[model samples]
Target: MSSTALIFHIQRFSIHDGPGIRTTVFFKGCSLSCFWCHNPEGRHAYSEIQFVASNCIGCGECVYVCEHHAHQLKDGERFYSRALCVNCGKCAQNCFSGTLELIGKRMTVKQVMDEILRDSAFYESSNGGITLSGGEPCLKSVFIRTLLEQCKQQNIHTALETCGNYKWDKLNSLLPFTDLVMMDIKLMNPDKHKQVTGDSNKRIITNARQLVLTDKPIIFRTPIVPTVNDTIEEFSEIVDFIEELIELRLKRGKASTNDANIQLELLPFHQLASDKYKHLGQDYKAAQLIPPASEKMHELAEIAKKHAIDVKVR
Candidate 1:
C-alpha cells in the first residue's frame, strides 16, 4: 500500500458518528466550503495550527519559544501574528499547557488500523465499527479504500460520512467495501447549493442516485442551518426528492416494496464550530447562526412521517 492521505483526527469511543461506539478517522481536505462547516480545521489538507488563548496562562512561553516572534504579548494579552508564523510547531512542543495546538497529520493505512484494532473489544461489545469522515474522504480515495479493505479483513463494519460531492466513479470504488454510506444533502436547488456550498449539486445528486441503485445501505443527513436551509418548504422539497427517488427505484425494479423502510435523518445545526474558526485564525460568518427550535424539528419529523419515511432528529 502507498501512503497518500493527510488525516486530522482519529477520535475514539465516539457514539454519535455511527452505530453504537465508533472510532472515526477524520481525513483532511474538502471539496466544498460550506458557510457553516463544523470542522473548519479539516478543510485544508495541509498541517495547520490553532491558537486557543483560553488555555494560555500568559506565561509568555510561546513568545519565548518562537524564534520568528510569531507570538507576542500586548497589553497583558498574548497575540499570535499568523503572518510571521512558520507553523514549525516549536511552541506547541514547548508549551506545558495545550495553549497552542497543531491540526492535521499524515497517517498511513497500517498506522490508523493499529489504533482502531486496539479498541476492538469496545467495537465488538457495542456493535460499533469504523467511520471514515473528514474534510472529505473521497479526496483521499486510495487511502480510504485501503483502510476499508484492512478493516473488513479484521471483520470490522465500515461506514463513510461524506458530503456527496465526488464523481460517481470515485465513490463507487469504495462502495463494495463500505457497509454504510452516510451522506449530506445540503440543498436541492442547484443555484442555492452553489451559493451556500461553493459547489454545484449535479455531482452530489448523481452520486447519491448511484449509491441508492447499488442497494447499499445509505443514511441521508441534512444539516439544518439557520438562514441557509431551515424552512418548512426546504424540508418538504428534500422529503419529496427522497420520495421520488424511492418511487423511481420501484419503477425500475431496483427496489423492493420493503425499501420504503429507508429513513432520512435531520441534523439541527449548532455553534460548535464558532470557537474552532477563531482558533484557526478564520472569521465566523455565521456567528449568530442558531439551531432550529425544538418545535420546528418535531414539525419536520412529522412532515417526513406523513410521507411514510422514517425520520430521526439528532
Candidate 2:
C-alpha cells in the first residue's frame, strides 16, 4: 500500500455517509470542478489554508509565527496575503483560536486504517463499517482498494461514496472489495453537466452503468440543485437511464446485479458548503439557492419509485 495519500477529513460516527455509524475518510482532490462544491477545501489536491474570521482574536501570534509574513493585522482587522503564504501551516499552528486551518494532510494507509479501526466496537454493534468518501474517493483507486481489502480482512463492511468520474479500470479494480457504492449523478444532460461541473458526464454515466453490472449494492444519488436539475424532467431522465442499465444487466443474466440491489437517493441542496468556500477565498456560486422543500423532494422520489426503484431523500 502506498505510505501516504492526501486526505482532507475523517468523519467518525457518520450516519449520513452509509449504513449505521460508519467512519468516512475524505480523500483530498477531485477531477471535477462543480460550481456548487460543498467541500471546497477538499477540491484541491495539495494542502491549502483556510481562515475563519469569527475565530480570530486579533492576536498577532500568527503574524509572529509566519516567516513569510502572510498574516497581517491592521487596525484590529486581519488580512491574509495568499500570494506570500507558503501554506506551511505555521499560522494554523499558532492560531490557538482555530481561526487558521490547514485543510489537507498526507497520511499513510495504515494511519487511516488505524483511525477507522478505533471505532470497530461501534461497527460490530451497529452493522456499520468504513466509508471511503472525498472530493472523489474513486480518484484514489489503489489506496482505497488496499484500505478496503484490509477492512474485508477484518470482516468490516466497506462502502464507497464517489462521484463516479474516473476510468472504468479504477472503478472495476475496487468492486470486488466494496459492499455498497453510493454514487452521485449530478446531472443527466451531458452539456448541462459539463457546464455546471466543468467536466463531461460521459465518464460518470459510463461508470454508473458498469457499476450496476456488479453484485455490490448501488445507491444512485442526485443533489437537487435549483435551476440545474430540480425539475421533474431532469430527474425523470436519470431514472430512465438507470432503468435501462438494470434492464441490460438482467438480460445479461447477471443475477447479482438484480434491480433489488439497486436504489435511488435524492439529496437536497444546501448552503452549508458556502462557509468553506469563504474560507478558501472562493465565491459560493450557489449561495442564493435554497434546499428543495420536503414536498419537492418527495415528488422526485415518487417519480423514481414509479420505475420500481427504491428511493430515499437524505
Candidate 3:
C-alpha cells in the first residue's frame, strides 16, 4: 500500500511563502470560486488540458492524434471541442512545441517527502521549511496532516497557507504538528463575500477565530482587490476582528496583556494570471484588473500600520 497525493506543482527555492528558502507544494482543488484566482486550473481536483495556439506551427499533428476529433481548425483558428474530448492526452503527446499541456500529477507521499528533504540543508541554514499551499489545503486535510507529520519526523519546520474554510476540529487536529498557520480573511460582510467569491464567509471567519484562540503563530493575509475589498471600511473591520481575537486570548489566559503582535500581509492584485488562464484554455475575465500603484499600496500599508498590525505588501 502506498500513500499518494495529487499535487499541481512543487515550487522550489520559494522565499515569499515563509521565512528563508522553502519548497512550496501546491495542492489541487478548492471550495471557493474566487474571481481573482491566479491558479484557475488548480481549482479542479483532476488533470486539465491547456492549449497555446501561438506555440502551434499548424502541423495538424494534434488533429491526427485526437481520436474523438476534438482538435479542429476552422477559419484558420484552432478550436477545441471540449465536449467531444475524452482527455486521452494523445494530442498533447503529439505536440512538438508543447502548445498543448497537462497540469496535474499524482505522486506518493514518499515521493513528495523525498523531494522536500533534498533541501534540508537549505532549510537548516535559512530557518526555511515546507509550506503547503493550495486550492484549499484544508479540503485535503488527510494528505496535509500526513505530509506535515512526515516533515516533523524529519525535523523540518512546517507551515500551511489556507483559506480557513474547514471545520474547527479538522483544522485544530493539524495545528500541533504545524509550526505556523497562514490564513486569509477575504471579506467580512457575508453578502459581499458571496457576491465576489460565490461562497459565504461564515465558515472561514469561524475557523480563523478558533485557530487564533490556540495562541499559535498565525499570519493573516488579505488580498487587496480594487473595488471589492480594498476599502477603508473593510480594513477597519479586519482590525476590529483581530482586536476581538486578542481580547478572547486574554480572557482565556493564552496571551500576555502586553503581547499584541499580530502578523498581517496585504497582497496586491496583479495580471500574472491572464496568460496562465489563456494557457489553460480558460477565459481571463479579470485581465484588466491592474494591481494598485506603488503609492496606493504604500497608503494602504500605512492604514494597516495604524491598526498596529505589522503589514507587508508583497
| Candidate 1 global TM-score | 0.94
- Clash pairs, candidate 3, are none
TM-score of each: 0.94, 0.95, 0.93
For candidate 2, which ten residues in a row score worst on lDDT? 251-260
lDDT of 1 by residue, 33-111 (tens): 9989989988887878888888888888788889999998989877888899888888888887788887877787888
Best candidate according to lDDT: 2
Per-residue CA lDDT of model 2 for 131-169, tens digit only, reads: 998888878888888999999999999999889888999
Angstrom error at residue 125, model 1: 2.1
Q: What is the lDDT of residue 226 in candidate 2?
A: 93
> Which one wins by TM-score: 1 or 2?
2
* Pairs with backbone N, CA or C atoms under 3 Å apart (clashes), candidate 2: none
Report, for every candidate in turn, its global Cα lDDT versus the true structure: 0.85, 0.87, 0.82
